[model samples]
Target: MWAARLAAPCLLLAAATAPLDARAAEESEAQPPAAEAPAWSGSLAAYLNLPRGNEAYVTGIAIANRGALHLEARSNYEGMDAYSFFVGYNLGVGEAVRLDFTPILGFVTGSTHSVVGGFEATLTGRYADAYIEFEYVPDAQPSGYAYAWSELAFRPVDWFRIGLAAQRTRVHDNGRNLQRGVFAQVKGKHVSGAVYWFNPASHEQVTVISVAISF
Candidate 1:
């Protein structure tokens, strides 16, 4: 009788574990664990500022992003010796014609100190894209000031772009408040280089060389 009793308990224990293992496998298949979050993509760009009758300088900018979150920094972008940091959210809209905009808020430091507000927007079509950016500085000397930069680009091939560029700034003063020019860019897998010639007229010509890397 003791032998049969021991065998009975062992059989019952095996029966219990068999259902437990089956239930665990079923639950695991029904609800899977979540996946890891997506990674951020970003870029850094440098511009070599060369203008007629002015000292040469370099402008640096960096951006880090994850999804809709945007972060950016600039040195010597707003003015000479100036630095700024910005936070913005990327908003995208449209299908046939698309628009992407980032309304950025930042603080200026180093040269001209102030609170800055602006937006970077791009309108895209079949073969061309139009981009515009503006920043307002309420604490500028004398009064509030606004600066703008714009580009209209046409792409005949995937890796090359020809564009018309315009800007209003005090960053480089060669006796002109507004500068307009032509630019061409050649892009590789992760790097791009562009040359801009502003005020193409011989009198107050300005040239800018841009090199950028994306990750």
Candidate 2:
């Protein structure tokens, strides 16, 4: 009788704990794994543009972390003929999209100085990526100017991408110009490279090549 009584309690305790064990197993299977923390990242790039009559080179650097402040700078190689500095906040819209709003201060060494504001938004997915940017500068280049650029790219693999880009700029008294181009880019663990061919409606075509390093 004593053995039966002890067995009865043991069975009750087992019955009481079985549901909890089952629930814990179910919860474990249903819950997603924790995500790893993001780290700081940055890149530096050099660009060469070849036109019919003139060749120009530009160097740029940018640094940012996840959901943090971003800093960027760009200048031409010819005595920093054209230079720009940007300060911005980076925001992630979703898992695959990010937006940066920045204020830019720029100068052309002996020509003009201006203040501008801009935004760049990028969408990255498994097979493709797209980017758009807009900038407005008051009293720039002897007059006010606005610029917009958009690109859509497809990535066939992890490293290579091909894209089409369109860019437009409007300048006071200088008229508006539109350029369309195709670009190919390759990215590795720490190195990236791209080439672009741009054709303007009323001007000669231009070719640009760029290489970058990331840290």
Any runs in candidate 1 off by more than 4 Å, and if so which? 1-35
What C-alpha lDDT does candidate 2 achieve relative to the native structure? 0.68
Q: Which is the leading candidate under TM-score?
A: 1
Give the clashing residue pairs of candidate 1, or none.
Answer: none
Candidate 1 residue lDDT tens string, 1-215: 99999999999999999999999999999997898786898899999989999999999989998888999999997899999999999999998799999999999999889999999999988788899989998987667788888999998887888989998888877767799999999999999999999999768888999999999
Cα lDDT tens digits for candidate 2, 97-190: 5443443433333243666577777878878888887766675645676667688999999899999987664211123266678999999999
Scored by CA lDDT, what does every candidate get? Answer: 0.91, 0.68
What are the models' TM-scores?
0.84, 0.67
Residue runs of model 2 more than 4 Å from their true location after superposition: 1-39, 59-61, 64-67, 77-80, 96-110, 169-176, 200-203
For residue 17, model 2's alpha carbon misses the true position, in angstroms, by 31
